[model samples]
Target chain A: MFAATMAAVLVTMILALGRAVLGPTTYDRILGVNMAGTKTVLLIAVLGFLTGRPDFLDLALIYVFLNFIGTLAVLKFIEHGDLARNAGDGE
Target chain B: MLEMTDLVDLALLLFLAVLAITIAKQRNLFVVVIVMGFYSLVSAALFTVLDAVDVAFTEAAVGAGISTVIMLATLLMVGTEEKTPSQPRILPLLAVVVTGAFLVFGTLDMPHYGDPQAPIHQHVAPRYIEVSGDEIGVPNIVTSVLASYRGYDTLGETVVIFTAGVAVLMLMGQALRFRQRDGDA
Candidate 1:
């Protein structure tokens, strides 16, 4: 059962990679990467159960937190063109 | 007998290969960064399957998380579109193929996955596994190895991360100062 679920996650990840590669717009690539990040968290959690090491869930949680920060940083940088720019500054 | 786990591993490896090829072919810096994030994610997954949970955790945090953010920050400094290479691709391609072939040849000597008698499994790993429970009393052998046995290395890693964070802050501060000077003028 875990194997099947892992296989499904792998499929989604592949599709996401494909989208990221073929992106006509930066947003499409960002979205694809974000989706892949979410899938990775799921994959890590499932892998924990598969391997009977429940402690691996901690890694998944870390991934989730990092993924959120990374996505936000990318989007913010794209919008502002400078990471050091003030958040409230109007373009 | 190849188990279900092995089969899943094979599938993941195939996906990683495909992702690598796509990333190599991509020209957009933004898309490359995103694809690299996916590559890190898949690598973390692969590490987990290899039963290296601690390595997997570090890979996800550093590779997928911190590195992705750093790359994006870099992208902000350098424009998104990748410049076409001025030099011919043939020399680089040959170099890459030769390096790849050498790596494959190196792998030929590696022990099969999960082989108990492998050199790595024979030496320090056995002692760590045997003594960690009684000596360190940590349930997670990885924690024991990284924290107690290899404390200096872990401390060094922490110091490196701290230095990087400080460097980034200093650079950002400089940029902000320049902006303020412009505003004052």
Candidate 2:
């Protein structure tokens, strides 16, 4: 049962990598990488259970937080054009 | 006789190689940076599966997260398209190929993963496993090894990260102050 689920997760991860490699537009690539990140998060969780070391879920949770924070930071950079822009700069 | 985990590990490593090649072939700088993050993401999963959870955590946070953000910010000002070299330098390519060949050659004699008879296992690992609980009183052997046995190494790593953060802040601080002065004028 764990083997089957791992296989499924591997397939999804491969597909996500494919999309990241072949996506046409920048947005397409972003979406693909983001999907790949999501799949990676799932892989870590499923792998934890398979190994009977689910105590490492803290690592998975950290990935989830970092992934969300990274994607948000990138999108905000894209939307606003700068991560370090001061409020007075806009004024 | 490959176990299920070994088979999956091989498959994931193959995928990582393909991703690396694709990243190398890409002329789009933005895509390269993002895909590098994806590569780190997958590799972190691989590390976790290999039971190196702490390494995986650091890889995901530092490799995938912080570096991606920093590189993307730098790329925004540097332009998205990669600059093409005027000509392919065969000497550099040859040097890289030679280095890669030597690295692969070096791996040929290494013990298989989790081999009980490996030299390192015979040396310090056994002692750490046997005594770290008593010495460090940590339930997690890995934590004991990292924090207690490898205290200096961990301290050095922390110092490296702290220095890097400080250096970045220093550089950025000068620029921000300059901009503020310009604004005042």
Candidate 3:
């Protein structure tokens, strides 16, 4: 069951990677990479279960927080050229 | 007998691959981003079927939530079209395909699914299942490996996050302060 699922995850990651590679725009590539990161987190988690190691849960949790913060920071930088933008910048 | 989980996992994987191909072939950028989000969600579901709840949660959050937002924000900055190039780079595409093929082939050596005698099942896993109650007392073996035997790796992973944060700050932190100073001037 786990093997089948892993294969599926891999297939998705490959597809996302293709998007990341052949993206028409930078944002499209970023989106693909972000989705890839998300898939990676799940891949790690599923692999953990398949391997029967629950300790991987900690890594997965930490990864989730990091992925979120990292994406936010990157987006902020791209949108406004700075992570710490002035309140008025959003408008 | 085909279990429902098996069918769902297979279907989702095929769907994700098709979506990816569609995104690659399409000229539209916005549609690619949206499809990518869907791809991530499906992948997350597949992870859960593998019994990796933690991974599924992270996938849904980062793939669907954070990544989509970043892509949109980036789109706002850089318009949604590619700069005209003299020629397409076929080499990069070929390289990626070859590498992916090799990886898939390598996984063939892995133990068959759910086999009780698989090395993974016979080795450290059984110990954890048996001794976790008396030793670390954690019910989840995944947690035990991450927090205990492989603690150093976890710390390294944490450091990686810290570094990424600092790097982002370094890139944007200075720019923000400079903008403020310019405004004051």
Model 1: DockQ vs. true structure: 0.69
- TM per model? 0.82, 0.89, 0.64
Off by over 4 Å in 3: A1-91, B85-93
What clash pairs does model 2 have?
none
The residue pairs found clashing in candidate 1 are none
DockQ category of candidate 2:
medium
The sequence of per-residue lDDT tens digits that candidate 3 reaches over residues A1-91 is 8867767777787777666666666677667766776776776677676657745666566556655665665566566655456968665
Which of the predicted structures, 1 or 3, would earn the higher lDDT when compared with the native?
1
Q: What is the CAPRI rating of model 1's predicted complex?
A: medium
Error of 3 at A88 (Å): 9.1
Best by DockQ: 2
Q: Is candidate 1 or candidate 2 better by DockQ?
A: 2
lDDT of each: 0.83, 0.85, 0.70
**Candidate 2, after superposition: displacement of residue B42 in Å?**
1.1
Ranking by TM-score: 2, 1, 3
Worst 10 residues of 2 chain B by lDDT: B80-89
